[model samples]
Target: MLAFLYPGLGHVYLREWLRALVWFFLNVTSFTLLMPADAVPETFGWSELVAAAENVTPEAALALAAITVFSMIDAYWMAKRQNTETEVEEGTTCPNCGRDVDSDLEFCHWCTERLNPESDEAEETADDSGANA
Candidate 1:
């Protein structure tokens, strides 16, 4: 998938903040390390890249190219897998009490109150009295 083609995109889609950050840092670091020394000094312009490639040994350029290609593939694959798994597990969590709820459920099972609707004032008063005992 195109997600794997670019690292961190998959994690972004999945809403995995830490995983996305790690993927971004890793891909960037690897790409930077694999690039030629001259390539590091300048903005990553096409001409600079070409000049570096022309100056560097063929073996170095090939290795760098391989690394960049492989990293892209790795990122894409990770994103695809994360997206699939996350979609299956996604559900709403209660903001007030931190309870997990099914997406279809409008109320928290534990609290037995309307999640997004107006709560009955009388019911709340009765519950409060019971809780104080």
Candidate 2:
């Protein structure tokens, strides 16, 4: 909810100070840089605030909205990652085709290539002997 309202607030709540600062600065900078010169009032007040909001360009608004969305996504994912019990290990790759394969499997699932380490060494030895012959 905080992220929805004030992008990156969720990161602050989660004690991710650096991420929160980065996201908040990005959102604020996008809004400030993209906003039209005439959009902002000379003085700060309720009426001026309303006028500024009214005068904001569609591009600036869209950019800020996109930043807000990214901030929320980052916050959500950071929190989710923090809460996760364990990190998933990367899967082993098939030597024949360089495709990821299950650790328990002995062959490349995608290419049907043999993946046994001992067999691969034996084949290498046989090839070396044949070459010598």
Candidate 3:
């Protein structure tokens, strides 16, 4: 939501401070560079609109529009990536089948093999040896 509306907001929400800062800086720079040289009038009127329009360069406007669209897409992508990572963390990869599964599941969906049995046994042996020492 924030990211789509404001560049770099998604990164900030995702705790990626560096990305957020960089994105914000780039967005600001794009806007600054694209801004018209002519000063707009204090009052909103047809004359001011015409003047502003006259000062606007087509290439600059196009560049600014591109930057805005790119920022929105980047923010959405980062948000999706963060969500996918969260999902992965809450799930498990089946050792025998190499498939993603719920963390609570005990068997692999593809291979139908018991999950983590060998690793569990190895861990148990290591723990026992450490306790004995």
Candidate 4:
């Protein structure tokens, strides 16, 4: 929604200051390049702004709109990727319920299923003995 309002605003919300500034400047440059001199609003008001927007060429509007959509998608994808990375770092998935469970727990907190601590110990012991040999 932020990106919809202005290209790269979503990045600003995501704490990507440099990316947001670049996108904001890019969109501003595009608008300046495409704006007709006659379309410049003479007054600072809603009516004047609407008139200016109405005067914008279809090509300019379409280009800016495309950039806005692209920015929104990029922000959303990056946010999701960051969340996934954090989840991977902090925990493991419960096999029984296919949900995240804390790594420190002996069983799946969601499903309450035993995680075979004995087998894990046994494997560790076997590996240690093999290393000693």
TM-scores for all candidates: the values are 0.39, 0.56, 0.52, 0.65
Q: What lDDT tens digits, residue by residue, belong to model 1 across residues 94-121?
A: 6567777776787788776566555456
lDDT of 2 by residue, 1-133 (tens): 6888998899999999998899889888887789898897999999999998999998888888888888889888988888884544454777777877887887888999877778779989999999999
Q: Estimate, for each residue in 1-133, the C-alpha lDDT of model 4 and write its tens digit.
A: 7888888888888888898988899899988898798778988899999898899899988888888888889888867877887765433776677787777888997789766667789999999999999
Off by over 4 Å in 3: 39-54, 88-133
Best by TM-score: 4
Q: If the candidates were sorted by their lDDT against the true structure, best first, what order would they fall in?
A: 2, 4, 3, 1
Q: Of the pair 3 and 4, which is ahead by lDDT?
A: 4
Candidate 4 has an lDDT of 0.83
Please state every model's RMSD to the true fold in angstroms: 10.3, 10.3, 7.7, 4.8
TM-score, prediction 1? 0.39
Better of 1 and 2 by lDDT: 2
How many residue pairs clash in all the candidates, one count each? 5, 0, 0, 0
Per-residue CA lDDT of model 3 for 24-96, tens digit only, reads 8988887787776574356789988888878878887787667667767877787788788776553388866
lDDT of 2: 0.85
Instruction: Quote model 2's TM-score.
Output: 0.56
